[model samples]
Target: MKMTDDNKEIIFNNITKWLRDSNFVMSEEKITVVTSEFYAKAYLQSDHEYILEIMSATGIETRFALRIRLPVSEQQLENYENLEPKEKLIFDDKMNAVIFPQRQSINIKEKSAFLEKTISIDPKSIDAKQEVMQNISNLLGSAKKLEISFDELLSN
Candidate 1:
């Protein structure tokens, strides 16, 4: 579905509602919104240090994504890269890898990485709210698990 202004508003409302109801304690002063011909985005930060970024794509991609950034050390990155597939960390086509619950994609960088989950958003669908909530939960869970794994790898 094309991301019209109405669709974008629906998505933004859903996200804000979810954040509020889920007790995320977002900083109202830190919230930001950006819109363009092709996409709409919201960046929100919580008191607990969780950064939630939501983007609705209107162009060819036509999707929605929820993302969070996590820190990683240089040694941890090297350890992750050396893991075998049996360890459940596999390289993507771009060769970036992360340990996870496996529902989200990780884009690793020098010191931090984004763990994101993308899904098709149909504002009019009956399941839209449930899908968005579930994806947000999954992204947070995956990030926590990855952080634990990184700490363990660093200790070893």
Candidate 2:
């Protein structure tokens, strides 16, 4: 679904406000304006920090990705284990963790009764990011529409 221009402007303004109030600090990498979109990066200030990438896709929605430095130390691994379950840690046997899209559902365990049960995320979380992307989409909405010239060329 595409958002209207007015809505896009509103969302962009709201996102900037939220980013400023967030606990994570926005670094130089945070603000990025590409040909068709913009991205925000938030860095955690810790011994082993992480980089959060927020992407507002061209004519789509905003999404987030998290990345940590390589060769995670033992202390960092332990700290990860301490995070609350509500945080939803995604780690393999090796203790590497990353967050997945709220809309995505995947089974973590095999041969379990819950295997068939779908894991879902809160609608609010998805909406927040989706709003960001929709804003970008709205900005490019007119350009995305097919031109009459294209149809005429096709007939020829």
Best by TM-score: 1
- Model 1, which residues run further than 4 Å from truth? 28-49, 58-62, 78-102
Task: Note the Cα lDDT for every prediction shown.
Answer: 0.62, 0.35
**Can you write out model 1's per-residue Cα lDDT over 76-133, one digit (the tens) per residue?**
8887777777653433422233433445788877767788887777777888778887
TM-score of 1: 0.69
Candidate 2 per-residue C-alpha lDDT over 33-62 given as tens digits, one digit per residue, 9 for 90 to 100: 343354555543442133434444455333
Alpha-carbon TM-score of each model against the true structure? 0.69, 0.36
Give RMSD to native, each candidate: 5.1, 19.9
Candidate 2 deviant stretches above 4 angstroms: 4-13, 29-34, 45-48, 61-156
